[model samples]
Target: MPGPVFLEGEKVTLRPPEEEDVDLIQCWMNDPSVWRRALDVNPTSRQQCAEFIEDVLQGDDGVHCLACDDSAPLGLVSLNDSQYGPDETSRARDTELAYWFDPDHHGQGYGSDAARRMIQYAFEDRNFRRITARPGSFNDASVGLLESLGFTHEGTLREAAWFRGEYHDMLYYGLLREEWNSQ
Candidate 1:
């Protein structure tokens, strides 16, 4: 029962998703390149995207932050679809971390910096014992970023996600609170 969470990093700062971000988010979602990475095929209209953002802004289950710099929007980072651990063990407190930066902003370290900030918030502020990130096996950049953040590659679900044409393996990475704190 702590206060709300706001994450700020070296190259990027994460704020609550805003109305203005709807347009940019819509563009990202509609882009085939971005959607394929997330295994999203159905097209969402601008209005649907706006409504989704509104829903996200209203919810409290997880924190969804818009990663940005001084000039323009970079991408989104969210600790979403959280499921509390049934018991008191370490696995009982964890959440799923998801993030994406515009393809144009790729390789600038924004995604990695933003993810590091979010994971920090998850452990120190949210009291989560662990955080899990699932990225497609073909998404080398995302996998590398997660690995760079000290997320250990736990497992892969073979042909679990269908994206452009064929099914792709889904890779899951995990980082424990204590492990991150030790780093």
Candidate 2:
């Protein structure tokens, strides 16, 4: 069975990963349609998926959740400590947002709903001052989603990422708690 719901949204529920979800997670991790835009493009084995679940269960530093609706899981959403500086102390008040959904579920508003909830949790519940997201320049959907969520285009790292046989730029976006509250 899936783990308990960690947060609920209009169209999705965020839950911690369970051991039974290893196969599905591994499948998503290895899917080119999903990983092509993600930072880590390497394929994930079932064992690695299980280990990730174990780490999450054992109190990992980040909040990792599976986005699910009534019937099944649609994707993964996470708020990890933003490594924006040379040390942890410099990034204590920031978190980085990341998510990916099943290709079949794209453009259905689930990703937006899940991401909105995670942003709320980061800023309001977790007391984070800012949340950041770095999407590849080629990922139009991701860039659009981040923009639609009230994130500002902070900057871009030109040719900072290598994927799909060539280098791609990475777009940086940030939303402060004040900005989110004002929206």
Candidate 3:
């Protein structure tokens, strides 16, 4: 299947995840060093990865895009778990953003590029007024990136999640359309 392009950036392009990406995703998600930063890093099999592709293709609650440049896939960026107001245009459309890049690709700014494009897509194309992110408090890189993108720290959910066998705070960040527009 031809993977439909979703959003593009100078250094990164986000596209609808296709079956061809499953192997790459499996390697990244199952790699211990890489998976630690993922939302769920459990050991995953090829079948599980295929199932994930299926879910992403369904696109009911969200969309998952693979970030790539000239050579290969760099990461997975997803905008999902959306909630809207009473009416379609009632102005309450909000969504959660989740992204993870392979550890090998870290420090190359792929995440930043993909995030900027995704935020633009959510605001201009999807009509989302607010975008939120829940990053583990200990993830300094993530927190720094979100802040740099003008995503304000909204609050902290104390001990709201378990990661690496310990309870960790979940930091909530919200970026309003106006905030992005001003940027």
Candidate 4:
């Protein structure tokens, strides 16, 4: 319930997203290489970024954190306590984990590190029973990160999303508290 706070790790730190991050996220959102793999690739303006940070900061359903070091903005991480399904009958008390690193920082394991911290927060701090992640099938880096963090591939929804002017499959991954603990 408390506003999101900075989370530190050996490689990086996760902090409450700030206004300065808007321009950085905007740059990433606008990059063809970055957004092409994202579920939403449309150009996002400063206002949208502000609204997004506000939503993450104020919304009860989630926590969003910025990944940074002593240098500059590296990426973003988020954990949402909500159901993927829209209807109550199909909903579960689940947390959704999402993350992204600046393309320049992609191969350095920042995304995986951030994701692991969020997963820890969900299972340990938040007492979540389970966490789920969905990455585009073509997004191999994300798939690898989730797998390394003990997320099992649930299944792929065939052509479940339309992005970057094409229909893409959505690969679902999940980790239960027991599973996370065992790992």
Candidate 5:
């Protein structure tokens, strides 16, 4: 079963991943349709999935949540501490947002509703200054979702991602606290 609700939206609820959710997460991780657009395309083992939940998802470095409705979890959303590049100074107040939904649940507006709620928590409760998102150029759904949430298309790294035996560009998006408040 999923943990108690952590965040709620109109069409979905966000909660922490529980031990029982390992199998489902593993299945999603290994699904080509799901991993193709994510940064890691490698096959994921059940053990790895378990470790991911116990370590990364539950770790203090970020806020990770499972997006669910009244019935079952539809996806995962997170706000991780941004990793600064060599030329950039580390901004502790900034976070990198990411999410992925089950292909079966796509086009239902659940992803958008969950993401919007996460962004609201980031700015209103966590007091994060800015949130960034990086989606592969090939993932039109992800790009559209980010844009719909009012994230600006800040830049793109050409052919920075390799998947499905080819390279694809990675698009960057950003949303500031003030910008979100204005919307």
Candidate 6:
């Protein structure tokens, strides 16, 4: 919506999701590994995913963009205005960055590339003051990606998220515009 038409990386392109991308979204979201790492076991129905695409196009709280490459659909990346709740992000001029990559493309730097592009757009194009991200404490790859992009590890909420059967921590990361500019 308010973001760019397309963001380019070396091996991927992040573009606004289209109606045709619904099926591809379903496929990636339904992947067991994706569910485990990203969605935390919440199953997605086709109808719900259709609604999601509509929401994305309409800028439903700033969710946008699907990542793809010449190979196939890779995953989804978003710059959401809201982080934990409607109240929090509503007060701050900040956005939350979230992403997931297909298991097949893991460790190929697609996630980092997409995130860096999103950060650049948020700071330069959108004029955002800061961006925040929260990743599951056990998710090392996500933590590494955020850290590599110069996001500060703000804190960890202990046992804040319950996934599968047990409770897991959530690590909060943030990058300020001043910090990004300094880099």
Give the best candidate by lDDT: 5
Query: Per-residue CA lDDT of candidate 4, range 1-183, in tens?
Result: 112447777687888766656777778877777777776756788898778767764465588787876546688788865665423233465878987778899989788877888788878887777899999988888998888888999999999988766788999998999999997
TM-score of each: 0.90, 0.92, 0.90, 0.87, 0.93, 0.86
Better of 3 and 5 by lDDT: 5
What's the CA error at residue 33 for candidate 2, in Å?
Answer: 0.7
* Colliding pairs, model 1: 85-92
Residue-wise lDDT of candidate 3 within 1-183, one digit each (tens)? 247666789898888787887888899879876677665757899998889788764456576788988647888888876656424465568888889888888878899999989999889988888999989897888998899899999999999877789989999999999999999
Tens-place lDDT digits, model 1, residues 32-129:
88888877788989899999888875466577888888647788888875566433354568888998778999999999899999999888877888
What tens digits encode model 6's per-residue C-alpha lDDT throughout 51-114? 8778764465775776777535677888887544444335566889999878998998888888
Model 5: residue 114 alpha-carbon error in angstroms? 0.6
Q: Which stretches of model 4 miss by more than 4 angstroms?
A: 1-5, 84-91, 163-165
The window of 10 residues in a row where model 3 has the poorest summed lDDT is 82-91
Model with the higher lDDT, candidate 5 or 6: 5
Candidate 3: global Cα-lDDT? Answer: 0.83
Model 1 CA lDDT for position 51: 91
- lDDT measured at residue 18 in model 4 versus the true structure, 0 to 100: 66
Where in model 3 is the C-alpha error above 4 Å? 1-4, 83-91
lDDT of 4 at 171: 96
Clashing pairs in 5: none
Cα lDDT for residue 123, model 5? 90
Best by TM-score: 5
**In order, what is each prediction's RMSD in angstroms?**
3.9, 2.3, 2.2, 3.7, 2.8, 3.6
Candidate 1 wrong stretches, greater than 4 Å? 1-5, 85-91
